[model samples]
Target: MNPDIISVVIDKLRKLSPEKASDLTVKNAQFITLQSLDLDSLDTLQLAMDIEDALGMNIEIVNFPATLTIGQLSEHLAEMRAELREPA
Candidate 1:
C-alpha cells in the first residue's frame, strides 16, 4: 500500500471523525475496523465518498468490505486506481 494514500485516508478520517481519529495512530489503523471507530452508517458512507473524491476515482460502494482496516482500504483504493490507469 502507498504510504501517501494511507496518509490521505488518515487525514480524511481525522477531518470527518475527529472523535475517533483522535484515538487512532498510523500503526493502529492497520488493525482497527471502521466499526470500532463508532461511525454510523451515514458517516461510513460519507467517508467512502470522501476517500473516493480524494483519490480521484469512483469506489464501488457495494464492493467495500465493512471489516477492512484503514491500511486495507488504502491498499484496495490503490489497486482500484491502478486498474483505472490501465488501458482498456
Candidate 2:
C-alpha cells in the first residue's frame, strides 16, 4: 500500500510536470509541495481527478490545506484507504 501510494503520486507528479528523469523522486517528494511543483489550481484539480480514477477514492482538493506536500498527501490517502477497509 505504501509503495502504491508513493508510486501513484510520483507518476502523477511527473506527468503533471515533465521534469528531467533526475527530478521528482520518492526521496525528494518527501519535501516537495504542490506549490513547488508549479501546480496551479487547475493542475491540482487534474491531479485529484487522476488520483480518484487510479485509486477509486474521492480525495478532494478542498479536503487539503493550502500548503500540501506529496509525502503528506500520500499519508492521508493511505489513511483514507485504511478507513474504507475498516468494518463500519
lDDT of each candidate versus the true structure: 0.78, 0.80
lDDT for residue 54 in candidate 1, whole number 0-100: 83
Model 2 TM-score relative to the real fold: 0.88
- Give stretches of model 2 more than 4 Å off: 64-66
The estimated TM-scores of all candidates read 0.86, 0.88
Which residue pairs clash in candidate 1? none
**CA lDDT, candidate 2, residue 56:** 89
* lDDT for residue 71 in candidate 2, whole number 0-100: 82
Summarize candidate 2's per-residue lDDT along 1-88 as a digit string, tens digits. 3889878988887888997335778887677777777777888898888988899888878855547777888888889989998999
| True-structure RMSD, every candidate | 1.5, 1.8
lDDT of 2 at 40: 77
- Can you write out model 1's per-residue Cα lDDT over 1-88, one digit (the tens) per residue? 6887888888878886787777666788788777677777777788889888888888766545678888888888888888899999
Native-to-model Cα distance after best TM-score fit, residue 43 in candidate 2, in Å: 0.4
